[model samples]
Target: MSFLLEFVRDPLTVGAITPSGAALARVATAAVPRTGSPVVVELGPGTGAFTEAIQRRLAGRGLHIAVEVNPRFAQHLGALHPGVDVVTADATDLAAVLARRGISQADVVVSGLPWAAFAEHRQRDVLRAVVAALPPHGVFTTFAYLHSRWLPPARRLLTSLRARFDEVVVSRTEWANVPPALVYYCRRPVTEAP
Candidate 1:
C-alpha cells in the first residue's frame, strides 16, 4: 500500500507521508544486537521497512516478532515478511503478545511507532509496555523526523524516554529517507521492571 493512501486513511497513525526507506531502516536498527539469538519485537512495522534490516541482522537466528495495530498493515507484513510472527494487536499489550509466544521478555525492541502523532498518555502507555517487555540491558530504538525533532510532542517523547532509560543516544541524520530522520537508541539500567 502506498504511504499517501495509508496516511489519508489515518493521518495520526500513519504519521509519515512516505514509508520508511532503506536508510532509515538501517539506522533505526543499528542498536540491536547482531548476535545472541535474542528475541526482538518490532512495533508498527508499516510496509516492513525495519523488518528487512532486522531479518538480515538476525540471519535466521533468534525469534523476531512484530505487533501492528492495523489489520491491513499487519496482513501486509505477514505476507511480505515470511517467517515473521506478525501479531495484529496494539503495542501497549506487549507483555501479553510475548506471553502468547511463551516468551517472558524481549532483548530488543525496534519501534516504527509514530510517537509525535500520539497523545502523551498513549505514548507513555506504549513505552511502559516496551520497558516491561525488555530486560534491564535491553535496547529500544525509534526514530523522529529531523525537522520535527524539536517539536513539542517530539520533545515530550524524548523526556519520557530519558525518564525510563538510563542511557539514550541520538544518531546522526539519515538524509536518504523522505524528510530525513534520526534514530534514538535507549538502554535501561539494572532496575525493576514496570
Candidate 2:
C-alpha cells in the first residue's frame, strides 16, 4: 500500500487513492466470461490489488498472466499472488509477452492502467496490443475514475472503443470507490478485423 501511495503521487499516473474496492473488482471480473481453461491477462496490476480480484474471479480455471512495468511491484505481485505468472513487462507489448509465454490469444483482458494519464497514441497502442491478443468473443474490462463525470476525453475514448469492439458495455459504477469510478466492459467484434 505504501509503495502504491508513493508511486501514485502523480494524479495523472496513479489516478486514485488506494486500489478499487470489492464491488468494482466484482464488476471487472464478471465482465469477462469464465470459459473452461481460458487465458486471462491483467495489465498494470499495481500492488496486486486487481491481481487478487482477478484470481478470485478465475477460480483456478485458466492461465492468468500479470504484466507489470514496475520491477519491484512485479516481484511483490509474484510473492503475493502465488498462482499468477507475474511478468515484468510493458502493457503495450502484450503480443511479444504472450508469444514468449506460448500464448496465442487471450480469452479476457482486464486493465487497471490509468487511461486518463496516457497520451492519445499510448492509449491506441495499448488498445491495439490488447485487441491483437484477444481471440474471438474475448472481453476487455477497464476502469477510469469519475473525477469529472462530464469529461470530453472520456466520452471520446468510449466512442473510439465502440469502433473496435462489438459489445461495448459500461459496467456498474462504483460510487463507493476511493475516487468513484466506472468500469467499461467490451467484447470482441464478430466481424473480421479490417
Candidate 3:
C-alpha cells in the first residue's frame, strides 16, 4: 500500500516495496537490551517495522529516536508509534540529531537504511556518522538483502563496516523475510587516529 507507493515514487529511498518482516525485525533489533535503559537510535525506520520491535524490547525504558528521510513515513510512524521520537532527517546527520537531544552517544544503533541504493560516498558518509554517534562499547546492527550480497554497493558497505568497527558478525539469513536477509552485528567502534 503506502510502502509500495513510496517505493514507486522514490525507489532509491524506499528501497523495498514491502516493509521488513517480523523475523528480520527481531534479529535486527536483538541488540536492544531487554533490561536497563539504553539510548537506541533507529535509522530509516520506514513504517516503524523495527520501531515496534524496539519499543517492545524497551518495555517502557530507554530513548527510542527514529530518523527517517521521508516526511510521510516519519509522520506516519510518529502517529502510529507515539513513543518514538521521530525526526525527519538524513541518516548522515545522526551525530547532530543525537546532540540536539542533549545526548552524546547511542548505546545501540539499528538501521533499516538502504545501503545498496546509496552511492559509495554516501554509504561512507552515513557509516562515519554512525561510528561518530557511538562510543567504543556501542553496538551497531544493520541488514543486507541476500540477493544483493555480491553487488558492488553491498560489498562496499561490508568493507566500510569492517573498517569502522572492531568486530562485525553476520547473522544467519532470515529466510522468512521476503527475498531473505542477514544482519550484521557490529561492536566496538574503531576510533580513527588523529
Candidate 4:
C-alpha cells in the first residue's frame, strides 16, 4: 500500500506526507541498543519506515513490537515485517500491549508518531504510557518536523518529554525526510524515577 494513500485517507493517524527516509531512520535508531536481548516498542511504525533499522539493531536477540492504531497500516506492517510482533493497537495502552505478549518492561521505544501534529493531551497520554512501560534505563526516541517545532502543540510535547525523561538529546536536522525533522532521544533517569 502507498504511504501517501494512507495519509490522505487518515491524515491524523498517518501524519507524515511521506514515510521517513534512511537518514531519519538512522537517527531514530541511534540510541537503540545494538547488543543484548532488549525489548523494543515502536509506536506508529507507519509503512515500516523505521522497522528495518530497529530490526537490524535487535538482531534476533531482542523483541520488536510495533504498535499501530490504524488497522490498514497495521495489517500491512504485520505482513511486511513478519519478525516484528506487530499489533493493531494504540500506543496509549502500552502496558496491556506488552502484558499480552508476556513482556513487562521495554528497553527502548522508537516512535514514528507525528507528535507535532497531535493534540497536547494525546501526546501526553501516549508518552506517559511509554514511560510507565519502560524500566529506569529505557530509552525513547521520536521526531518532530523542523517546520512545526515551534508550534504550541510541538512545544508542549517537548516540555512533556523533558518532564518524563531525565535527558533529552536532539539530533541534527535530518534533511532527507520529506519535511526536515530532528529526532528526540530521551533516557529515563535511574535515580529520578519516572
Candidate 5:
C-alpha cells in the first residue's frame, strides 16, 4: 500500500506500482558474492525489495549500503533492516557517498532505479557515477521491465551500460514479477577520460 502510494505520488522516482517480487529480487541481487566481505551498494532501493535478498546473500558478512532518494523509504528501510546503512541521497552521487564511508570501490552495485522514467542525461550521469564508484573487477546489476525494454529511455540505458562496462549480460525474463523484468549484469568498468 505504501509502495503504491509512493508510486502514485511520484512515478519517476518510485518507479513501479508495487514493490519488486521475490523472483525479481533474487535475479537482481545475484551479483553479490557469497564468499567474501564485499562492499555492496544498492541504488534507489525503494522499500528494500532487493535489499532483503542482498542481506540474505551477505549473511552478516560485508557492508551493505543502500542509497535511496526518498526520505520516507530510507527511514522505513533503515528501521526495518537496521543492518543496512541507508543513505538518503541521489544515485548520481554514488562516488561521493562511498567516499564518505571510506569505501574506495564497491564490489557489487545493485540498482532498483527506474531507468525508463529518467531523461537521457540523468541516466548517463547516474551510470557514470556507478562506473566511477566501482573498481575494474566490480559488478553492477540493474533491471528493466520487459514491457518497457524498447522504450527510448530503456534503450539509452542499455547504450550507457554497454559504453561503461566491458561486458553487459541481460538475464532471462523474470516472469513471476509483476509486468515481468530482466536483470543486466555488468562487469569491468571501462573508465574513460573526463
Candidate 6:
C-alpha cells in the first residue's frame, strides 16, 4: 500500500489507495472482453492487484501483458504473476512493446495507470497508441477516485477520451474503495467517428 501511495503521490495520479480488495478486482476484471484467451494488456499493475484479478478471469487462457514503470513493481509482478508477461516500460510506448511481442491487437486494455497525472501530450500519446493497438470491439477499463476529480480530472481526461475512444461507459462506482472510485469501461466503436 505504501509503495502504491508513493507511486501515485500526485493528486492527478490517484494511485494513493491500493484498492486491492477482492470485490474491487472482480468488478475490474468483469469489465474485460468476453472472448476466451483474448490478448489483454494491463498498465501500471502495481503490486499485481489488478493483475491477480485478470489471471483469475483468464481461467488459464489468454495472454496477459502487464506494463509497469516502477522497477520494484515490475520485479515483484514478474515473480508473482508468472502467467502474465511483465514488461518494464512506459505506457506511452505500448505500441512499440506490443509490436515487439508480435501482438497485432489487444482484446482488452486494463489500466491501473495514473493517466490524469500525465501531461496532455503524454496522455494523448498513450491513449492514441493503445487505441491504435486495439482491435474493433476491444475494451478499455480504468478507475478514478470519485471523491476527487484527480483520477480522470473530468474536464481534461473526459475531452481527450471522447476524442480518442469510440465510446466511454462509466461502470458502477466502487464506493467501498478507500477513497471511493468509479470505473470507466471504454470501447472501440464499430467505426471511427469523423
Candidate number of the best lDDT: 3
Per-candidate RMSD, Å: 1.5, 2.2, 1.2, 1.8, 1.1, 2.8
Q: Which tens-of-lDDT digit does each residue in 143-177 have in candidate 3?
A: 99999999999998999899889999999999999
* lDDT of every predicted structure (CA atoms): 0.89, 0.78, 0.94, 0.87, 0.93, 0.75
For each candidate in turn, the TM-score is: 0.96, 0.89, 0.98, 0.95, 0.97, 0.86
Inter-residue clash pairs, candidate 2: none
Off by over 4 Å in 3: none
Model 2 lDDT, residue 4, Cα: 58
Q: lDDT of candidate 5 vs native?
A: 0.93
Q: Which regions of candidate 5 are displaced past 4 Å?
A: none
From the highest lDDT down, the ranking of the candidates is: 3, 5, 1, 4, 2, 6
Prediction 5 TM-score vs. true: 0.97
Determine which window of 10 residues in candidate 3 has minimal summed lDDT. 185-194
Q: What is the alpha-carbon lDDT for the whole of candidate 6?
A: 0.75
How far off is model 6, as Cα RMSD? 2.8
- How well does candidate 2 match the true structure in TM-score terms? 0.89
Give per-candidate clash totals: 0, 0, 0, 0, 0, 0
- Measure candidate 3: CA RMSD: 1.2
Error of 6 at 4 (Å): 5.3
Question: Which regions of candidate 4 fall more than 4 Å away from where they truly are?
Answer: 189-194
Q: With candidate 2 superimposed using the best TM-score fit, by how many Å does residue 140's alpha carbon deviate from the native?
A: 0.5
lDDT of 2 by residue, 111-187 (tens): 88877777777777788888888877888988877775567656656766887798888766788777788888888
